[model samples]
Target: MLFLTIYPKLHVVFALVSTHMADEDATTTKLRDRSHIDNTLRLTTAEPTPEFSAALKKLQNIYHSAIKPLETAYKYNELRTHEVTDGEITSKPMVLFLGPWSVGKSSMINYLLGIHDTPQQLYTGAEPTTSEYTVVMHGEKSRTVEGIVMAADNSRSFSPLEKFGQGFLERLVGIEMPHKLLERVTLVDTPGIIENRKQQERGYPYSEVCQWFIDRADLIFLMFDPTKLDVGGELATLFKQMKGRESQIRIILNKADNLATQDLMRVYGALFWSMAPLINATEPPRVYVSSFWPSEYAADTNRQLFIQEEVSLLEDLNQVIENQLENKIAFIRQHAIRVRIHALLVDRYLHTYHEKLGWFSDPHEVFEDIVSDPDKFYIFKSILAKTNVSKFDLPDKEAYQDFFGINPPSGFKQLSSHCSWTSGCLIDNIEKVISVELPALLSSLGKKETPPPAKATPAPPPPLPETKPKNRWRKD
Candidate 1:
């Protein structure tokens, strides 16, 4: 409201005084400067008239009004004494471990999650302990006795994911952290894509959830029990649902602890060739052999040694999870890139104005310049309307491909180029998007903000206040 009141009162200088000194091409150059705007509409900064004096005074006062409060707010936030600890998602991901009912999904999850008593049967029985999606977030480790809402009907019912997203995106943007994999990548444990027959016949309640998630999932760790590794039927159908898209889709050979040494080799080879027709896997899925239930022989182990090495996983703590962080960081780096692009011209035009205007000059003059180019301002508004801040996701594979047409790289160079993709790409993208929108912004400014050229009768300057010449040597 304040900006609106002040903007019209100020003037857009055509700098007529400098025209006589400029070269012959000055007229052509000034006219050709429309590269920034396809249609250049000139509004002569007419010589000051009687009414101009009051408007100039009010416009100058607008600058006077804006400075102090903005300065005070900046100082208050910068000098805070205590800083809170906020790096939860970066340390532990909100991993959602999901799979078929009997695939040892919870068993390996508990192992990786480090929730165990070490061989006295931590999970009394491991026959798919989690049938519904669950989100396990960061909490005090001492209390492995944490909160767990094991199952829910509505997919978006759980609120932890929402809060986690808010905190994670905020941290990622605030830190400008380089690690791109993910700081707030929530590990969502979803129901497995069951056999297509089950989806067709009984109509698995969550197949819709599965498809929706696959379309939006950051990474999918598909579990293929060793027994079914050689058979491509189930795997192929799941692959069909989420194929061609790039990033993370890992195949885990669960229940490898159930397979024999030679059979394990056979299943691995067979699954690779069998599924080659369906899933375009860069690498064969990650295969792990281990029981969700601890082995019988490990039952007699001493508590301290077992707890130190296996239960608490304290011995090789850093080494165990160090490699995974790289993947997670890559996801978040992408998010920062989008936020940076939110407005390209607004950032550049304002900065350029500030650089020229300098200190002691008002900053509102910079935005006033934006409103000055009502054409440009309209262009920016049109482009911004197309973009929604909520939709940019670096970690989720499908959004990159479908929403914005960016997909994960198949090779390490693809990763490297993307990781180092210029800070200016967002701006470049906006420039391209708004080229079509420039005329709109320009037309708007022309109507609401830009002024028409001077009229045929040039207006005379308003007279200054009159004062009688002081008598010589008069001092009060």
Candidate 2:
């Protein structure tokens, strides 16, 4: 009897493991083949200003020809897997909405998309209704594209999101329509955060997916219903993850019509207090108090305030559209610097190992040596100092360790033979793109009368190009 019971349990476990492995294999096959039925070229349909388009195209050319090769050869792609595609740089500004269930995330999206009618574009309700990550974009006619098909397409920026696995892809969809606002900006609506759901319950990496969107988004709206002010579970985790990105976040006290003026004040105060620990910012994030749904304002006394707040929010969105090119350029410059640092650090790590163990030694031996010695960080510090790169620009320690821990460093070993800190021409090419090309691109984008307040500490403006510049970049 003991043998029989134990054998059955073992068989069940084996079956589950097999099913998981099979699921992974299927996901791998689907991605490798890129044979989704709707896998057609996804060209950008939204029309940006002609000048903006020309400048962005030029920057994209420079990036692919000059920066991408260095990033790929130095394994910077492995560190930050999201390759900057042309679509990503040229696409409309993305405004991402994230918040708890029944908080009006979808409703706000619909309101902005001008889909105010009986049948909403995205399902909305008091309970959890939106169960997918939806990207609403501009198109001639309204249509929905499946996530698997969208993810498989190289033209879209979402290919990087495929790493989240089939579970996330299935929950991702693109809703295209001929909306006026979408012509200027893209809106990403994420699934509502639930209070107590575990990662297994969700069946995907929720925070990681959110972080991916957060990192790329020009504006992030963290909407909240007046009824539920407590931030716990997934919502709290997200707030914590958004530490460095405080500038992008705009807190929305949605459905403010539900509260009277006195109650609204109390609720807003309470919400800020609850969030203070998580946000840890010097001041509370800008909270726009408004009810997004059409029906909410009809019966509410605070209709005027809501309208003013909504207008303010819309103006901010418009600013995002105006600043999109500059934002893209800013992001590209930051990414290039980070990639350069990543490449240089990887080169140094490998060179040190090559000197110690020579080419024949196991790569793991160097990784182990680094892991064993905490003092080895000083060596990296020295490299950063010499390069005038901040130590903070380095990749996350855990991620760096995991990469070197799992992957054989033979490729890096080969890279070290030719790509040392001082000798590599690729470094010079990348720097030229940074110091010369990008700033020139920025200048070509004629100065806006009053540019929006920068989302982060502004990158120091690149220095003027040298008179006798090295012809490091490709002529074309």
Best by TM-score: 2
Q: Candidate 1, residue 163: CA error in Å?
A: 13
Residue 74 Cα positional deviation in candidate 2, in Å, after optimal superposition: 1.4
Collision pairs in model 2: none
TM-score of 2: 0.79
Over 1-476, each residue of candidate 1 has an lDDT whose tens digit, in order, gives: 57645664442122222322331232234110111110111112322233333332332232223221222222211212111111321234333344555465555444443343433112323233443454434332222211222111122223222223332222111111211122223345554435544544422334444554464444565666666443435555667767643334555555554556578778878766776777665755433333332322133333222222231211112222222333323332222233323223234333444455767776566545544453444534443455543333212322222312221111112111222244323334333323433223223322332234645544332221244322221122
Please list the C-alpha lDDT of all candidates, in the order they appear: 0.36, 0.71
**Candidate 2: where is the Cα deviation over 4 Å?**
1-47, 118-120, 358-378, 413-424, 448-476
**Shift of residue 149 alpha carbon in model 1, Å:** 8.6
Worst 10 residues of 1 by lDDT: 32-41
lDDT score of model 1?
Answer: 0.36
Error of 2 at 185 (Å): 1.2
Clashes of 2: 0
Candidate 2 lDDT over residue span 1-476, tens digit each: 68658799786667557744643443234111111101111112223546766787888888886788787787676766556765687677899999988788987776565474535367766557788999998889888989988888778878778889999999999988876677777899988888888877777888888888998999999998876775887788998878878878899999787678999999998898788878877766778898775443445466556655665566566556667788888899888888777777677666666567757777677667864452465546755686447767766656667667655566664433444555466777788888889988888776434323334443332232334222111121
